[model samples]
Target chain A: MSNEQRPVWHKRVTEAISADELAEREALWVPLTEEVRELVSTAILSEVDEHAVALARQHIRAAQEILGTKVDTGSFGMHVNDEGLAWNWGNAATGQKNAVAPPLCQVPIADGVRYEADFGAGYEGPPGCLHGGWIALILDHASGRAAHLEGNGPTFTGTLTIRYLQPTRLGPAVAHAWVETRTANKFVVRCTLSTEDGVTAESEGVFVLARWARKPQED
Target chain B: MSNEQRPVWHKRVTEAISADELAEREALWVPLTEEVRELVSTAILSEVDEHAVALARQHIRAAQEILGTKVDTGSFGMHVNDEGLAWNWGNAATGQKNAVAPPLCQVPIADGVRYEADFGAGYEGPPGCLHGGWIALILDHASGRAAHLEGNGPTFTGTLTIRYLQPTRLGPAVAHAWVETRTANKFVVRCTLSTEDGVTAESEGVFVLARWARKPQED
Candidate 1:
């Protein structure tokens, strides 16, 4: 669909999020997302007693009903369209409190975005290694963020290439991304994943600026 | 660590899982996992009332305590060593009931492995598109599975390259992988992601047989 004809949600990009709002939203949601991640991890790893399971189920059901009554039974709208919210907060790679997130925190650097994370048992692939897919997720997020910093409007990933140099141990790790090159509507970003030991993975991604949302001058 | 000296858990592999056992385990866990995923998705999207939040917290605490008292607290052991259970069940990409999972079901074709899945709201990225990271995750899993089917004992992803041909919509999609080439200890696998429309993404991965766990003859 043409950008002009697209839904309001599609037009709602990071440009709509202010720095102050991003910080505030991150502050409010980060802790909650972390708690949820903890809950998910514990729930999966913990061997629950029958009584506890029953109690938990009851509580969840009650919460669902109460929330259902009080809140509109509507789709959790597109992340971008959510007013004053950081889309990354609900993301699976870097969302702070999202249950599905590895719960990485993104820190801005001079060149691009950097992330610090600990891939817990919940994201294991090999015996004691982090899942390769999760590695890609982190790189993809970081690279996209880097591309965004290039001062272009929202962009979509066109291609991503990842090299797993070694097994990423399941624990604290670091990732960094920076814009490598930029053309008319494409940004090539490079990212790396490392640990105290050394680099574990590296990635390069091509992010294409949405054709419909392209800058007027570029057109 | 050398294979012989490595921990027992490291030695555990899918080959050890019998077909009957895998089936029984899948039957037992798939539904439960799906329930958990639903709970996770709902928890994130639902807006809670103050009273409901308090009640939910209390119930969660009680359940945690009860489960804590009745169950031994320890890290969930390595998946491969978890008897006949499929580790993929709780995985974020291909897991059946994981909220983060696209829940791609892998089916064996003559040459390699194929997967069919639907990218739900939980995995959305660019407006109506599937997250680029998710596409990478699916490709990684499929390629690795292809490497495994090549009669190799076990493999680790050495590198993965993905090209997105078009936006993968948030609905039913398909993926396939096959061993493109094999060397002494490495298998090059190629994979593709597609919808009814056409190919959306393609990937090439270099899977290296784990150093410590090479087949005797190959070694």
Candidate 2:
């Protein structure tokens, strides 16, 4: 359809979801994802030479405070098309520091529940090895997003499983996710990370309602 | 025991575990954990200024590469007497940064297996939040560690699950981790990241093989 011919609510649909709405929506936060990509890119490009790395880190900290800091994966954005297509480009495993954002990639296999991406630079840890926490972050986001895609009610991780099969070296890395099971609002998602050699890590998570966080709103 | 009265092996134990030994002991790099504690403390104290953070990170990366790294229970060294009694004082999470040698830290309990730690100006990310990758580093380690404590076989994480619950603000945030299940060599570990109000992100992981790396002559 021509841009002008689109439905009026199309504007609302495309319009950025409010932060609250983003949080309330199950695994959907595309607007915030764009903002984060920009934020991280700016932080990366503005580093001072004397302490480029430190400067980049400071920027990350500031972003976390506003965005809400945690151990691994943090708040990212998502998108759901009218065609039921969903894209999650934020909450990247790496590349949150560069001018070019890491691709929020997806795969058609696994019933559109699997995905992967590669991010780099200021995010490095243990020399060439990817930071352990970063691995967890990506797995969490991928699996959680997978669970959300499984048509389950809002779910939060109640349990998690991880296995570091090998030392994940830096540079290009691959990730994959898939839904394993669903009962009621709970969805089980499984995923893995791999290097050129083979699988480096694998994970699974159980997403459930925060129940208390899901209280009915006042009229 | 007095220094002179201590056993020769005890003195060797007190001495830092060599990088070679660390690599050879893949089943449980307990020696490497000790070294990491020292290394983290050294890196933190070597320079408190923002410029020195990179240097600290470099040292940590170097040690991790040579000696390998291990997940934690927020505590590092446990002084065990011949009687099986243990007193853990080398915990990175609770120890002083300057005295701790390596910068290893125990992520305070945020909820379950979720946790948060600020690299601070000493450890910067894009601008404010912890480096996204660093977040993963901690989470992966924690997930694997939780799995180890929960099951049999020298547990290594076969998989990890995480969700960027929020941006993971840089300041004082919290992380949580817990075990979901244990079946044979497979153990499931879960984690979460949160700011002051409540849980912002969550993670889940599975650890398997128990001593996958531990073979008679592999190392």
Candidate 3:
């Protein structure tokens, strides 16, 4: 597995933008992403009539046309700069440009990566609980992030095992992940998801650094 | 274990809407949800100028306002009827009204549950691959759906173990799940996610029938 020759299928665009330009672009898009997420939550809870739904559709269509006027083909692969700055805004877990992503805010934790998100109507599962699949997503993302920080390269999920101890309620929830063990190129990470009801889900995962992304100066 | 008294936390609402009304509602909301998903993908790959971006925001805001004028209080829990019709269009895995859900289309199969989805920019993780978390989601959902049909109750995922054999490329992916073993109230399900590249990920899961959802006539 250490020398697994997986093809590099990811998009890595080399951009000439400066740090300031990247920040400016993020500023421009973050609000739009947030608003669209809000729109999703609202749409889920909305009990509007036919007329209102029609009007909403009209406005949404207009927005689509405007945005679609000039678009890039395929997915939003990672955009990296020569100065070593990299951003993948379309990431499914924590992408700033992904409205479907969970509204997770990463906290500066002393031990591992801590993420806090209010599981709303949009994240419902059994009744008033966060979907079990989202639990897996959060753990995978947090664990990969933790591994990425330590590995200093892209870490892909190799295997994941999760236990749903309790139904994660739809409200403020927290996730904490840290690398439990690691070799030269692989990491074992553990994570937990908790709400006011305490730890609802936990996971253990294997992550490995992509062979192509490895640097010659090994640890 | 069969008599495990886990708290019934799932929302089971009895609505008075007719079957015809339910179909009508789905027709109305499914389009809105679909368009929003398209918007999300568009926003991720859009490289539009400042003016178009600004204009898109305004239209999106207007849609939000119109939808927000009348809203419900909380999550769209399962809406059931006296005639045994149930609809949870806000479900995370395949809710018709949920724009955040992967665009999965369930196909009728003789043995188990089957689902197909075209993973786009909105579901990217590694470069051009589907996020690992979403793979877990699809497997969990398809397996639970399979168990639900045979068990005749809402089945919750108790434990899940997934082995990602290869990178699941973003595009047409198929999932097939079936109950491999079963007890009085618990089902051991197996599922696999496949793309044109072959089976990329597979899973084994424990699904338990919700005690509250069990009918008096047991198998």
Candidate 4:
């Protein structure tokens, strides 16, 4: 089926920035994001008393004040360059600038999409287990990425159905997604989340390439 | 309808701490969590040069070092007191200590359950819209909370089906969840997500109270 329906919200930004500048900016933000993520994990497990906690808060507030001096107005939507490179650095699944996003790293696969992350203290739900919500995010992202690669543009998840086989442990986990079938604008994809205990959750999703995003079909 | 099925993982921790200490600890971490979340939003919008960025990193690192000095091992699961009060500040939905969680504030309502949050850049997707995965998280958590209240114990989402009516816009949004039907242990809950754009997403889920958590029936 085709996704002839109009999207409620979508945007593409083409910025006039060089490749070198982008790389340099990424180098700066990536470390800060990682450190912020680590700080979260550390805060959860830290047994510090009142004095240390108070001092940490002071340091955090100072950092915030410095960064807040110059701010943008709204969300970081998709930004692309003339070189055919697109990046959404605020993406919740694997944004370079987002600290709350799981540490999902894309892996090269011959026919599909793969992502790996070591689920840590901040990602836990039930004791020693990955949160159910994060699982949904991972499955949706991996499947969407697979569809985006095949469709050669952006894709949104129309519907997703997930089955929880067991609780996923809070450690290294992998997600692998591949398209099962496709039409002119819609693609059906399947994804699985696995850990040391084997497959913990699996999902089937319908993703759509909006009409405006479709490439011209070669005749 | 009852869940006799054993869970993959669940635990209850009764700590040797008092109410005063708990309150003091909460006072310390809540602000830090808020600041960190705000810092993430600021970093996304900041157009700062390298000097400002470099300086901000030092402050963030200092905070991390101070917090990381005294750390515990593994995840922070459910912790309770002898007074029957429970707190899981590490929860992914609205954990007071978790910076990644949406700022969900529970509102007292006569029916079902209600939660409100102003989703910001950290929760953004599709331009100025909330991510689909987070929609899933909000719906799941709201429904689970409803079930937990009625069942008077922990509940799990067995299956959830979400229909995305439109893209939920960023900023203030509300989640309303209510139990549709129930038996001795199983509940079918329905939830709706709305922003200024009306109802954007809705869900129906099956929540089960694990057998081990159920209380004895009256004679």
Candidate 5:
């Protein structure tokens, strides 16, 4: 299918689902996925017997067969609305239970948003420090979410710049993002990532509203 | 422990392990971790009963208890040498079978390096498109690896800038990184991420040699 003709979820769809319902569903899925995520970490680090691995694979395959193929189609499945509800449970950065997600919790603040998460051994990069890429992932998600909240529409990251100030330790980390400026459909968002010790990284991102959402005058 | 007093892995240690041995170990670890990774993705997407979930958790806990904790240390575990043999199989970005790792295989070429990997559903951000943050993860890794290969030692990412030209589809992808310029301990590197269709995103990164690696003259 052509780019324009492809099945895409528009920004307006955010209104179709009630925030309370989405939040409730997310609550249910998050813990289930979190269990699976912990399972992954354990499987990777643990030295399980071949018999256990075999049995686990059998169970996994059975589950897969039962679930079949169901795909999520939308703003890359990471859309966050004004209510601070995002239906991106399958996303790697913020999806609850997604093995790859840091599973950040979005907290609405006065002017912007804050993400709370903890990185464990699964996210290690340097000794006790959080992996730099994972750091980028968190900032990228927070920035995009910030843009979506401020822009009131679907947006995609155009450019992201991150500077590693110091080693961010694994465990509880906080990331905050706010819209620095907006002109037409473009948003300039800035973010800071920190741990108990202090700021570990900072980032700036330019997010452009999806093509379909852009006003003719802006184009 | 104080940051300065912590037992950080010195860049000089890359010389401690032979390149051939590291390569061999990575070759072995990659497939094993790949299995664990597939298990994770499968578990997340699978449909299982509460009993299955409970059973899976039990099995996972048993494994964790049996294995105990063994943390990897040194170079923050992302070290790659001049020859491009990085002992970073435990890293989140490129570690084999690491659910977090895209598990890129670095191929040394004349004047640059190429990374090859497949991003599956676990890394998805927009429907079939690879997660943008994961995109950043791959670029950040390739750029840092490029700097390490060219600069003759370990380097950390100082700044990374990425532009998403289009939605990068999930599946086999190729990323290439080359050094653009250098000044003292700072090296500028450029990277491009693409699938069979063509270039999806491009990045430029500034990498600075770690503090302990810098010489008095370079400082």
Candidate 6:
């Protein structure tokens, strides 16, 4: 559907979900998820409109070429509309091609968002420490969700600061994210990750200039 | 053996070994890989003193705690030292307790260090991108090796900064590390990670306050 012709559920879904809840909803929103997957796949196949798929493919190929190998264990999926188009490419914790990630998929909800996943070995950093970068990934996703919730089109990680309070052990961990403030296209997002007992990590970030790269494709 | 009574080789091994081939008389001067492992393990276990057996038991318990649980999978085997002390708590990429980690093991080279390992599907981020955290873990290990080489005693990562110049893919990758500078108890280390052809990641960091933490016994 065209941007103006898109359904309201897209907006509702984007606004009503938490990062954790959205992750849980990945299976439930299979139709929407599949729709995005198909659209992006088709766009890439046709080489027609300049879309997120084109941009992602370009980047992915650049990375692969530089690294000198084709990575088959991962993929990028996307969906589009006037409210915004979202693309999650080769997400490590949840990509089909990723052998070292936790299983993760996210959707939209309310003014904030939530995400949850179970991680196992293949991400070790310390003797028993979870590689710190995985922690940053979760934070970045949460920050991105916070931006998405505030309608900040799309943005890149301008700066990210993470504190390793304790060695994050790999296991089932849950994360929650949401917008704390917004100004023009700039947004402040607050997030937290926890397991069954207490919090494992906390994060907050500022996302700016939604659609900074290209005006949220006029659809 | 107590610190004062330990074999002279124990103290000599930590020093830099010459790269040139050793004659039979210089054999003791050459650092053997197995010997180095034993020495470090011995030094690490030295702190346990009378608690060596208890420490081994803890290692077993910690390993058992994660095994067959939802988290134990592609991790490395952690064993105690000849001093009969063990530390299987966990590691970022490949500790026995870190379920989300990969298999990482250190090998002592002529005068520095090298690491070997394989990664799989679960650690993806971005599309086909290795989760940023996985990169950090590899970098951390590389940096840590640099610290170990400078003979700066075991050090904690005071701070680590990583720039994701490009997304990393899964599969076989190699990392090499060495010391850049040393100041008293502080040592500066730098390292890099590469695929088959060229460098993919580079890291630099400071390792300081040698042996700040007393052995478990002293604590």
Candidate that would win on DockQ: 3
Candidate 5 structure quality by residue, lDDT tens digits, A33-121: 67656655654454344555555555544444433344332223345667766555566776654677767889879878899987765
Q: Residue A22, candidate 2: how far off, in angstroms?
A: 15
Compute DockQ for each candidate against the true complex. 0.35, 0.07, 0.50, 0.43, 0.32, 0.08
Residue A142 of model 3: what lDDT?
89
**Fraction of the reference Cα-Cα interface contacts (below 8 Å) that each candidate reproduces:** 0.32, 0.10, 0.73, 0.62, 0.34, 0.15
lDDT of 2 by residue, A111-195 (tens): 5355565533223333334555556656665766677566543445555566667866554566787787866566677788886
Residue runs of model 5 more than 4 Å from their true location after superposition: A1-28, A43-86, A214-219, B1-32, B48-62, B69-86
**Cα RMSD, each candidate:** 5.6, 15.8, 5.3, 5.8, 5.5, 18.7
Task: TM-score for candidate 6, please give it.
Answer: 0.48
Question: Residue A160 of candidate 1: its Cα lDDT?
Answer: 92
Compose the digit string of candidate 4's lDDT tens values, residues A10-118: 5567998888989988998989888888888777778788889889988888888888888666677788999877788888778898887876899999979999987
True-structure lDDT of candidate 4: 0.81
Tell me the lDDT of model 4 at B206: 83
Q: In what order do the candidates fall by TM-score, top score first?
A: 3, 4, 1, 5, 6, 2
| Candidates' C-alpha lDDT | 0.66, 0.43, 0.85, 0.81, 0.71, 0.45
Give the range of the ten consecutive residues with the poorest summed lDDT in model 6 chain A.
A5-14
Per-model TM-score versus the true fold:
0.80, 0.41, 0.93, 0.91, 0.79, 0.48
lDDT (10s digit) by residue, model 4, range B49-110: 77888898999999999998997666677779997778878777788888888767899898
Candidate 3 — which pairs collide?
Answer: A10-B127, A127-B11
lDDT of 3 by residue, A16-135 (tens): 999999999999999999888888888887889888999999999998999998887677878899999988888888889988787577999889899988767777777767888888
Candidate 2's displacement at residue B39, Å, is 29
Query: Where does candidate 3 stray beyond 4 Å?
Result: A1-8, A215-219, B1-9, B215-219
Chain B vs. true chain B: TM-score per candidate? 0.74, 0.48, 0.91, 0.91, 0.78, 0.56
Model 1 lDDT per residue over A1-219, tens place: 233322223323344666676566556544544544555555545455445555655654554454345432212334453354445333445444346767667876787889988666466566556768888988998898788768456778888999988877666788999998888888999999997669989998899887776878986
Q: What is the TM-score of chain B in candidate 5?
A: 0.78
Identify the runs in model 6 with alpha carbons over 4 angstroms from their true place: A1-90, A95-99, A104-113, A117-133, A144-159, A167-213, A216-219, B1-78, B81-92, B95-121, B148-154, B169-172, B176-219
